[model samples]
Target: MPNHLVPIAFELPHITLRGLTNNLTHKPLIVALHGWLDNAASFIPLLTEVTDYHIIALDWAGHGLSDHRPPGTDYQQFDYIDDLHQLLTEQKWENVILMGHSMGGILSSIYAATFPEMVRAVVSIDAMGPITTESSVAENLRTGVLSRHQRRAKRSIASPVPLTQLIDKRQQHTELSGELVELLIKRATRPVIVEAGDGGTQVVWRTDSRLRNASLIRLTEQQAQELMTELSCPMQIIIADDGLLAKRGLWQQREQWFGSAEIVHLTGGHHLHMYNTEQIWAPIAAFLHNIST
Candidate 1:
């Protein structure tokens, strides 16, 4: 419930966006990006475990309270980096720590490599693999369009429930404390729902289609290798044992990007961090501490 936000102009004078930030004793900044379909609340448990580093958690365009996608334009995954770039420009924080989950994780990795001098360290929660698992760009686009279409339909008509009620709904999907759940609920839903169901109403969308579509441009293995080599700061990679990788060694060989890097393995599926924060957050804390000191 300690999350806070203040509206700010990001790219254009007329185009302002909400910048979400988390504070714990006013520590160093760690810009955190949530995974696909998730908001900044995704980092709550991890944030609670850390006593150092102020966490900057963001909602991707069309995801959380951030500005929805520009009229007819679909979500562009690359633009996420651009958004953060504008944020850093406005906030005037360079060579800061960056951490993210899933899509956000991939984004922080890309930015750290792209802006080596501006990033002091980068952490990928579970999104630092080769961009595409497919062979054709057309196929990628096709896949993206279908997924995005579904997401748009869902979010566009999602109904709002009372904050407490919304948290109950989210609990159906995950087992989080009631208080933590409330924090997430308040950040996502509005005060009213025009179409509340008889006993309870459903939020129109649980996921964003634009983000799925934006990932059509995947990096080839060669391209990924090149990006890995481009990283100039400290880096940390955390992979789950139950993740989608066919082989873990692929990531092991890519650590050449940083002057110093560490790898840790967690047990569970892609979302082990959310489901098992107490166990996995330890190494992440150590990694960040070492980098900042």
Candidate 2:
């Protein structure tokens, strides 16, 4: 945990989103969004490197300390944008800059396109835009429904495990440094009574299980491109040479969608922003400088 990062929460009518901020006073607003399964702590390294702006890093609903959607409801991409809009409206903020990583980057791009007036610029790390599916609508729907049902059927209270063991598991899966993984895991777990009448307790992950379910539908490649074309604000996309966007190679074809966006390529893994903090910040700082002037 960065000593400067302060924990804050926004209370919306339906849900409360939790986040960390370096400053809350009047300054250019830079809203940071983390990738799927990652919470606000994902930006701890990057946020520590920049202190001139009022930066708020949010834990998307259900991912971190944020409130989960009402029961029986499913998570959707559009809902996140709506939540973001509501937050900004409640805060009376406008002309903001969005800095996001991976899934966060994807959502930031979509939001910037949808509401260009509210966004002054966008910084996307390891993401270009929405992911399109080649599967037919019916097939996609079927897969989505079946996946939900399977998840619900298989849902069982996870047995309490040693926190270190859990941290180790997450580090292996994410390939992030143990320190980084520990920072995220500590925020995403809670202690629970595992043995009745024995005063024994253990910690379990706090992430909403429903988050693992697949999205019911995805935009087609053409539809995604059309949406990307609507993004008029200045955009900076940082590509990790070894990240998901690079691995997929789809961003190469989509570059034309954004007429003249600044694209920087760095060498690192998917979570490059977290591990390669300084390397990632150089381009971002320059981008901010260019936009501010």
Highest TM-score model number: 2
For residues 1-293, what per-residue lDDT tens digits would candidate 1 score against the true structure?
54443322245332445545544426777887787777776776676666667776777676667777665677666777777787787778977888877787788888887888788887887666446454677876787677767766776554554555667776777545676666566556555444455645334343344555545567677777687677777778888777643145545555554436677888865666666888787888888777667
Candidate 1, after superposition: displacement of residue 230 in Å? 0.3
The lDDT values for all models are: 0.67, 0.88
Of the candidates shown, which would achieve the greatest lDDT relative to the real structure?
Answer: 2
Candidate 2, 1-293: lDDT as tens digits: 76778999999988999999997567788999999998998998888888678899999999889988887888888889899989988988899999999889999999999999889999999999998999999998998899889998888978787777778788877759999997788778887746554444458888898888888988999999999999999999998888888888967988888768999999998899888999989889899999889
Provide TM-scores for the models: 0.76, 0.95
Clashing pairs in 2: none
The residue ranges of model 1 lying beyond 4 angstroms of the native Cα positions read 2-15, 24-26, 141-186, 194-198, 206-209, 212-216, 245-260
